[model samples]
Target: MPNEIPSRQELIDRAAELVPLLQKNALWGEENRRLHEENLDALTESGLLNLRVPTRYGGYESDMRTVVDVIAELGRGDGSTAWVMSVFAISTWMAGLFPDEVQDEIFAKPGVRVSGILSPTATAVPAEGGVLLNGKWSFNSGVLHSSWNTNAAVLLTPEGPQPVMVAIPVADLEIVDDWHTAGLRASGSVTTVARDLFVPEARVLPMGPVLQGQHRSQANADSPVFRAPFMATACATISAPAVGLARAAKESFFERLPGRKITYTTYENQAEAPVTHLQVAEAVTRIDEAEFHARRAAGLVDANAAAGKPWTLEERARVRLDLGSVCRRAKEAVDILNDASGGSSVFTTVPIQRIERDVQTLNLHAILHPNTNFELYGRVACGLEPNTLYV
Candidate 1:
């Protein structure tokens, strides 16, 4: 960590410079099923890992727009790296929801990278000083390089099981290398298991209120970046990377267009064909549309945070809707580019293949899926409550 925090633009510019290196590491990361150490070093050195940390704790304390923009730049380089960074970045924000004491202990140290899953998949029974937690959480992105894992467990009270968040050191949890997937392989989003681990009461945070815009980081109480409603901004954080992946596909396609010829066609070069022109136009428009929705959702999240008010149900639902649109359009744009690039583009060596696979995986995410969010939004629009708990 540096004594002086870099400006938001400085952070974005730094991420832009790292694109090539990230791209270079993409294949190795995929092979090893984790991010290369060099990529981690680059992210740490650039201060991008601390994008959501508090300024008082040597973090940039960037707004939602800046955070998403930085992630977008990283996405342009490599989808997996951007996905991991986005997950860890939001995990840092989630850390602020912990008690002030817990925040001090975690953020007071430098190079504190945290990763987590929001699902309450474990059970927390009352103990002497804390609670005994036992559960297994899957899809914990960036867990390999993380210092801590912030997860949720159901608290067993007399009434019933109430969900609560807990931050546990990486040393205490068991990492299960079960992340065998065709896409986003470098993310290392594996399963994490905790058996009979005791978490101090101080580390416990109420999940329901946190989603409703309540947090306990007194050091960040005055910062609008930390005051944002967790659920309202959650979709924007993950969806921004999809938009970036679309942009990466666009760049990759054009770069390969110069000498490429349509096989057995009248046009010598693919770029010279009228059909190619239409493909480019449609793909670019779809990419732009995805970016538009992503930016709009991010702006709304920032505005709501700046106001320090809870987001209404309608507002939160709209964010989800916007994120769904972003995911749908981004994947479609990448598919168009992939198809336009011809059969050669599907080769493993071609960057478009990986980009296509990554965008498809991203679109399948439960929260960002078009149909799921569309249904959720429609339920809310019809004067009915949402079926899911997060919103």
Candidate 2:
């Protein structure tokens, strides 16, 4: 049977329906420093894991907007779960950029999960049939639950050090259970070590071409879902989780607002205070702005993909700006709400504290850092070239 591409709303609804289950298992994931099996099962069963898989492989091949919406919905449930899902979505889309044979091998299994990291931390040396991969990649989200990992490595070439993306089976690499973190603990983003691992030439892709939308996959050459520049799509997809985190903060705050009182104050109802009103209004506005940036970024990717348009430097920078803006605004919103929740919100049972930490972690990411993105966009706007190629 052919895979039916669901409407955007249908996919979002599916994600929305899984919130309770995700919430139910959030604590378990946090406590264990990994996602619960129940959460993974729910995501796989919901078809959310297949959002970015190739259509020929029974996956949805959803556009950026649909991808963002679904991820945001998941974020509304659990930050770590949503963070891992976003990584899977990006990695699966990257898998589509590989040769058709590789895609067949990867997507052949049901509910395929691919985790990835963008930094070229590993080195690849030429060997008989392929290259010998060696080095360690940290912050490999979803690696513990993934079948494959799409990692970046520097390949020695006559021209110079050429960066390439390599797809390796998780079993082939050594996993380090050192994922202790203050935020997104459940994501289980442990470090993976590749000790002289052999990578076939077929599974290796040059990063330069892939970044510019010039990929080796003839099979997916005309696929609209794979049309946009890699960074643009990634920035757009990653930004959605921040919006989700902000929304989750909002939900957590309002859920506890009605009966709550201003501790050490005469106000019987915290919601009745003018300061509370201001905080709510400010947080809600920031959340709205974060969503606006997220949707705009997704819209840019989707529209460009559909039209097959060339990306201007400013436009590329704008995607990064959107990512930074979403992270900044979302974190701000979460902080506001978390602060308003008072001392009681610090309890393990409260979701706002976790959401706050998750948003802060997001803001600290090198690529997603608000100030870095803002500077990049400003540089481009001022007629200067972008400092990095990842834009």
Best by lDDT: 2
RMSD of each: 1.4, 0.8
In order, the Cα lDDT scores of the candidates are 0.89, 0.93
**Best TM-score among the predictions, by candidate number:** 2
Predicted candidate 1 versus true structure: per-residue lDDT over 1-391, tens digit per residue? 4558777789889999999999898889888999999999999988898888877777778888888899999999999999999889888899977888898888877878989888889999999999999999998999899998889889998988888999999899988989999999899999999999999999988787788888777777788887777777678899888988999999999999998899988778888899889999999999999989888999999998887777889989998999899999999999989998888877777899999989999989888799998898999999999999877
| Candidate 1: stretches off by over 4 Å | 1-3
Model 2, 1-391: lDDT tens digits are 8778889999999999999988888888899999999999988898889899888888888999999999999999999999999999999999999988888888889898999999999999989899999999999999999999999999997788998999999999999999999999999999999999999999999999888887888889998888888999899999988999999999999999998999888999998999999999999999999999999999999998999999888889999999999999999999999999989988988999999889999999999999999999999999888899798
Find the number of clashing residue pairs for candidate 1: 0
Clashing pairs in 2: none
